[model samples]
Target: MLRSFSYLTDHTGFCGTIKNSPSDFVVTEIEVTEHSLRDTQAKSLQKPMEVLLGQSSPGLCAQSCDGGGTPVPADQGLRWAGDSCPASPCQNQHESKAELKPGLEDASVLDSLLGKAVSELLNKYACDLKDVWKSKSDANAGTREFSLGPILDKKNRADLHSAIRQKFPFLVTVTKDNEMIVKGNADYRELCQFVTEKETSDFFKFLDAKLENSTFSFEPDGDKEHRKVVHHFINRKFGKLLETKSFTVTDVNDQQNMSIMVRFREKGWSRKRPAGGFQEKQDLYTAFTLQKENLETLEAISFLAAELGVLPSDFSYTGIKDKKAITYQPMVVKKVTPERLKEIGNKMEKKGIRIHNIHSACQHLRLGQLKGNHFDVVVRDLKHHSHDSSADLKKRISEAMENVETKGFVNYYGPQRFGQGQNVQTDQIGLALLNEEMVKAVKLFFTPEDTDDPVNNAKRYFLQTEDAKGALVMLPEFKVRERMLLRALNRYGVNHEGCTKGWLSIPHSMRIFYVHAYCSKIWNEAASYRLSIYGSKVVEGDLVFSEETDETISLNDKVHVVTAAEESAKKYSINQVVLPMVGHSIKYPGNKVGQWYHERLSKDELQTCKFRVSPLQLNIPGCYRPILKNVQNLSYFLEGSEKGIEIEDNYLNESKVSLHISFDLDPSCYATVCLREIMKCDF
Candidate 1:
């Protein structure tokens, strides 16, 4: 089979070169030895470009002499941008543009150089230049076809790019346009090896087209075989797409500036220590704190630690909350030094930030956490309302929660919301980027063979966006996953690469496991899980015996809740579970009831309601239908308070976010569930 190879170039430069190289336009004259479509090497070669330049001004050639006597070629005006070519290390020193083309029109020369670079790159990669051009021509002549193989997906692309960066950094180009240009360099050569190992060439073609500001969409093709081939290549290189490790810290104390210890499960090269590997299950820890100074922002004690040098680097937080409101989150820090830890404590005290506690942990948090966020909000300003208004609001909230199976909040933009009205959009761009990253990770693990190819075939299994619109749109599924990931990141933010927040963490001695379930239409499927720490299998039937409901079965209720495991058990280290809640109710007239959340539902502020502190239930739109649901939904179990109000089996699913709270004498006596209820108070 004839392999097709192509290269894109600056349009103006391409036109000039095509005009001058009529004789040697085919592959025979300009030789190409490599077949890599991606960045393979970083050598700065300027030979082909030199030849192209000579074709325009023959007088500049060394052979341009008169008579039999040896004569030197006249210096035609043409300046070299830099001193010497980056590719030729031992050759002549590069000439200055002023010296080479002092009198030549500069603009035209720039145009020529652009085209020359493209031609040079093409000849360098396409050993059989004639075959590549013919293939491209055939593609153009045959139905204007383009192929959207799986490799173009965001996740796969990210993986390929990451590999290129690690293996061949110099070949990568970061242009103002965000377009990655791979000139001849070590990275470029590695990319060729990476793609060739995948046993496919389609992805390379796509990358080549992208380099020229074109896309696979330009010549649309429907044969997915190429995509599958690329996918196989990706799978061969990367294993599991979504693999994460979590650590539990036991010595967490908000008061002492102690460090929390943690480790990983699968193991890999540690950014903190190069000596670490994937086999020995790494072990390390850091010191930090999480505080809800404001209702919106959950500032970490490690923020100061990073400034003071307690931890190795700043840290990584999942999300940034509002500065005006009080919030709580999780964070993680990598390795830290003792001197840096003391400095961190001093800084926190100076800044009036308290360190709650620290503990030893077994691993680093990759994603997911215990339950969801518990939001306690206070709404100011009051209007004339009957005593029943609170009760009605509560009722409405309850009904609304059950009906949607997702959580929602008042249109209060938490600093991240971007759109407006019916078109209101959230911080989806960030979510989209995360999804792209996940896809890339999957590709990287499952298809290491195709590490260099540009197209990411693994995207087909997950949600994907178009070529130009990627990293901008977040599907509902991605959004939900992102929320959980963000929570974990925030809770354990630490000195890490490419993270937003510094280091942060959460301390909890008690451990519990919740089964994350999914429901779609009438059928629901739950994937089995094993002990994260001890590697033991857990069965759903062993956890929940059975549940009795009083109300008539509704669409939401129609979904079966197969108790996978106990909500709270010491044996399980997993903290939270993700479940998809959906109701058959619509926006219009229905038998469904609703309630007001994040606010006191009724004036019965004195009424004591008993509730249990079940895990927080985060409700998000169906992965397929997010736009239909305006707000990201979340709810949790607020069973009872310390006062012990007689609680029913299910008070109100809508009012599930509220639970009574009380403080006995010490702050340690504070109950997370009770605190949740108080936060919902209208006061």
Candidate 2:
């Protein structure tokens, strides 16, 4: 069955073709980082500074003296000066001078100067600083600066600088207005000095040692534009290892003005602790950027796993990339060394896969961990109306692109969400599973289609002859899921229990993918119905996220139905409207659209409350998705047929033109759906 999707733009979209060649489509993943995850962790770690310092009472500072110093009220602004307290009147002044004595190496001095909270946080990484100073023979040992997270008080900042200079003579302090930077002085090497555009390889060599937790600083020789290129190059090469931060530094030749300085250090290096002290557990997963041409994400990972003698389940990634396109995504594997993966990757160059930027990751890659995907798509063989000239066609295409950018597009799951081929619809198997018809689902899996592929032929042979062994012979080796199911059926016989076993033999991800595809189909139909009935207006029955809804909240808990008063007041915009993916726990719209969901579910002989299957352990509590998605950084350019033809012996006619469109979509949004809006044709 063909699924119809609605478009947000009203422009008459022209016909254009995509995926003429694998190179015509390129997808690059935008990754999530530790800095982004910190916001999610902030709410859980909400203890006050005094609590971290182990203070018995609130507003009491931890003392620096051997025996606990006399408790002074926090309002007095008086602190302990070790043993040299002359009197209460001059106690504060005496404490400051005594604490600033040269060669004073007490860690408590840091607590007194920067407050108990900041001192404890710094102490957690004190091992990193101590290691640098201890390693005098190390070439990479150098001055390392740590940011004291924004201090707005002028006196507090000045106190921090003075404390570092006097108490710790080996350390130097500088202030960028209100922010204090504490730098540890040690022997350093100029790894790459005055690096020009042509000498990027030297910079890469320096980055190669970054994995060993080395720290170094270099100033690239360039203007702003050239430096920008160098920055991009560094990110592309050493993104996983480099903990990059931009700061202003006085120019080496000209001290009057400041220049942009980028600091590079190994990720998570600062958090290391001294030997036998409390330390973070080493990461079990190794993540790397997997770049491939004409290979599915799983297929590439499976190939690598097979080469490395590991299970395919050992690898994880944020999302699947297109099989027929050049794609780059981050993938992680548990207990695998970067060296082993790199060795296998070097051999995979001939197989259209290249892996790089390998590093240790604290956790496995999870779905929806990426910001989004950036697509560079080339649409060829553009057809024009008979009345339109080349210029007119280009003008219309330009207008369509602008309309898509301004009005957005329907956020429908693309056809690829459903498995390829017309012989068996993946959603049918999903529906059978939900209904507890395991035998029926298994039969559907083996259902013969019109396609003449070898896999289908094997399925037909197996169904007609009941010969699992024979079918296995004809099936390709790469069809792991099919082989596993057949093997299970062969051992258990094709009965109810056997079919259940066969279905369970498939990977959990693949099984869940089928059910999600069914939910996506329902969502696509409901979204089209909504646009047809209610145009672009925010209706009273529509659903929008509540004011309390945010990234930290669970998806199922974020739904809020639009009320009549709110709709009248125009509180929610059309873009804010969302549709449920249809589940037992999901709440439908309050109007005809909600009723439409019931009718649609009734047609399938299913109920919203029946999404859970206890025997199969499949509990799909569906989530809400936005009905519309906006395009970011959308731009397009027209190319003549002869200019952009990737395949030399082109099949397209001389009149054919290519439209190169580039844009970014948020996570879980499909680029093909956006292309459907631009072309007004099913992909």
Candidate 3:
């Protein structure tokens, strides 16, 4: 059962709009593909397009390559067999110091494909670019040519197409198997080679038209991954579509398909760490679409990285995703071969994790490197109002959606935002931390709940009573971090330094996360207050953010404050302004807003000004985020409609109507807010 939250349905006023189920909500991320800078510009730039084209015809493209070329991603021909190489490539993949072949940087390859010795052509454009053109076989007479520099650096689209096509040919010739036959005269063949083997076949569709026709013409294929392009709605969508499901139904299925998906496309590199021999430093990047629902990003990556003889810390990713949903993200490991990565991925498939689209990256991924996330949530078992007719239900949904689109709603943190809600919330612990109540914070972390498990309750009770020895003994092996804290207490007593060490023992990411949740709680309450008073219109000096700039705000950048004029100039431009995520460097929205933060901090006994700066310090460089989210592509339909729906076979209750709704939201924004506005029910 999802933990319930106060004000969850306050906006929508329909608390139990739809029966809540884990299977009902599905979130799929739209990944940003990063390309290597050293590779041919055409190869790097075509990644996203390559991914989309591969998905265009699942039947046609599935059999084709990933990211064009041979489809093993980047150069798959980095061989391990050689005089210098060990006999077994599989056993010594990490030790194999196979240098990336010259083909990737073979600018001369483009000469044959582009039909021009790039040295002369580049020199014609600008004599200064002489050094940019590499001459593999130059006589040094200054008359030689080979290829172009950082291909996309200054080259325009026309130049790229020209470079892509050494020469434009009249006919697209295909073999009996429908593979396009490469010919010197046909530069279109060269361009087609840049596309997937499946997509290359499509070029022949117009070949019949081109052979008999006067001019070349064909409709552009639809990019497989079509973006909604509108925006996310964190405020009004969530909490409304749900009715708190009872925990009694033990057999209910919350299948972790992650079909709605932890796929990250990290674009950076790490130092190579080989298993046996000195490793060749190569830029290793692999974008994986993980069908893993039960595994954390770190957990799955750690397992695979270990296979490559690297630590989980060696892998870099944009963000971690929910363990219960299907996800795709990019992961970067330096110097790891695609073959080894693929082999481990294939191995993982047996354990319910399917990894795909292994590729190379030029840049390493840091946290928060994302555009946003797309969600396809299904709300089941609509508890219909007795008097409401079918038309009325539809009208209600439409009007609710329209109102949200017009005025927008409060972007409160959802129940799941803090935690499962069964235990004392993280935000509450964060509040304790803010107040310098380390003991209280640690105690909350081990809150004794009246749970089905006695050992857990006993462990919590021992920790609660300061029986550190008992707590340690009672704590199960699964409570690894907690055991460390209890052991510290047992050894050092409840002194300040001991408590600090105990807290510090937790992972750095997690330690900061508690504070983040606290900040989120503060922001949510503050946002709710603003919504109650100001509605959607801008008040004088009220903070606002433009749609375009909001996404750029990071934990590192100073919080953006909207001016009164910026708020008025472009209508919707300054709609959903941000609030600070309370940190040492944060400047509160002065006036009542700023005062509100101080007041809340005071209530928690927290000193507002006290924050640490070191990585170990809790004084984080918190960024600003929109108080309200703008939702896009808002759509809903009855589960019994043309859109597929199913009856609950596991539940003991009668089957009710299912409402399937789909929308997109920004990264980190909760979709529950939109449902809250739609249902108008108190959750």
Candidate 4:
């Protein structure tokens, strides 16, 4: 109900903070290692982690802080040892001791050597560091429990304190101890708005108990429900959790690179060839990483198949990686000979498609079968700079990273998920389709934006005049979807009844995307609203998913009361809050959340039951999304980088940084959403 941060102090340790710009935020993917069935389940059951592959620069892993505040130059710090240290899964540690020299001990003499400006800078920010330290201590030692909450699974745990700069910039503390969050089973107590101080005094008293694995449980610290009646508040904020920071990301497609390796998912793939290479059996699989320059997977495969005299179907990929960015993903060729594949790979590389690790396997790949994607990204050319000093930049970055790392960032869908032109507008037209607004859907499809393409501009005149047939005539031959809609309208009239039929004429996949997008919009909106109202708290009548493979709970498994559920949910990370994805056969959550869903639909004049139109078989049963996203192996570092560009603008500058970041997310999680919280800017 309230956040009280008065308890933290410099006397106790904390994770320090630093800031980063999108100068060179490099994200490299860490492909999950293949495992046996037992290993797979064991890994799945392990607690989730928010650790990412983190290093401030391409090189330069900093050493852990020993609590006393002071700057350790790159030459002296263990983190900067780079190759000598285990940067990957860095143990932010004081593994090495500083051999203090004379004169440096005197702050003034050292300041003079570093320059008066640098000296003044340290004086300006030293107190700020203490405050940051105190705030962390408070968050760690008081109101908020010290547990990492699936965030501490990072291998860098013990040494994070040493790596965090305790002086200016990175002021966050790094402590090795953890406090258990208040769970239902803790010295747990519920405090409602109606309670009097006397009735709730006992609950507040437990705040002083030994917090670490105390194994202490007690009764509701209240003696009675006070006479005053208060309403139970539910989270109802309406927006994504991403902050609003602005930085430019260039060199995006500069080197759209991707290197992928695949493990065959089929069994009995050991067939060998007479020439020492594995013999290509019909069921044999060949796993490889397809690295192509400026070519989509399909395009790359198509070109290769043409040259090799094989159908593209000979190559089966688990999923498609981004065509624009340098991506790496595993792929397999079913029943393919290694020799022939090698020949194709050789020819393919000459054509800009470089295939790596084309080896035979016993199994084939299934969609979403691999562990997770690894990202190596570089955020470049930050336009805005409040200050040019490295100290200032690091300080800002430290603060942001500390906040994001600790509290976690908001999870939201980025703009790329939405299609161009009226196809998908945060699921607007899709919602219209679900609502059965035939005329609305058709009109929206024809609605041209200000930056209309030439094709769209050509059709705009006819569409604006309500001449559907004329618009169809203006559509180019390549406008397959558009022509289909026009043909339907030409046959049927131009009314809602006619347009509904026209809407049905579009490809089923395309139409379903629209519907799904709309559903996503609903989810985003609902999630935002709930976070605002409840601030990530559990409430009465919520439904929590039991497993990744399990679908949403049926109506029969609903929670009808609040009682101790809040404490239980908070303890187990089972907030039970979920939103419907706007589909038929989808049973929405119960109580306030469900009511809120209905309210949202009523405002949009839509309903889940309305997703039953057969025109395009858009009748998809919906899914549910948890309000929070689990992040694994979160780590980051920022350093001064030379890869920058200057622009003549109000905020554009030439300063650049290579903020190295690495993490693994579930298959459906959006990396953009996570980065948004850090950059707080448009990608």
TM-score of each: 0.26, 0.62, 0.54, 0.48
Query: How do the residues 1-683 of candidate 2 rate in per-residue lDDT, one tens digit apiece?
Result: 23455678877667767888888999999875556654533421221011111111111100110111343333332211121121222122111111222322466667876789977765544447656645766655645567777777765554455444444444445554346676653311221223532233333333221212122334523366655654565555444334342333446675533222222321112323344432223335688999999887777876787677776777877677888799999888876887888788668887789998998665466532577899999987777645445545655676788888888998887776676555678888888887788888877888888888998899999888877778888987667777888898888888888888887787766776778778888888999999999988898889885433111223334456788898899888888888888777667899999999999988888855478777666767677778888999998766665685443332334356677889998877888889888777777
Q: Which ranges in model 4 have alpha carbons more than 4 Å from their true place?
A: 1-324, 329-370, 383-391, 420-426, 449-455, 458-507, 547-577, 586-591, 639-654, 681-683
Measured over all alpha carbons after superposition, the RMSD of each candidate to the real structure, in angstroms, is 31.6, 21.0, 19.4, 24.1
**lDDT, model 1, position 28:** 9
Error of 2 at 317 (Å): 0.9
Estimate the TM-score for candidate 4. 0.48
Ranking by TM-score, best first?
2, 3, 4, 1
Better of 2 and 3 by TM-score: 2
lDDT, candidate 1, 284-349, per-residue tens: 444334443422222243345446444323343333433333334444554544344545555565
TM-score of 3: 0.54
Runs with alpha carbons beyond 4 Å of true place in candidate 1: 1-139, 142-289, 295-313, 322-327, 332-335, 346-397, 403-412, 415-683
Candidate 3 error regions (>4 Å): 1-21, 34-287, 294-315, 323-364, 367-369, 384-391, 405-409, 454-458, 461-494, 546-576, 613-615, 641-655
Clashes of each: 125, 0, 50, 89
Q: Candidate 1: TM-score?
A: 0.26
Please report, as a residue range, the 10-residue window in candidate 1 with the lowest summed lDDT: 508-517
Which pairs clash inside model 2?
none
lDDT of each: 0.25, 0.64, 0.47, 0.45
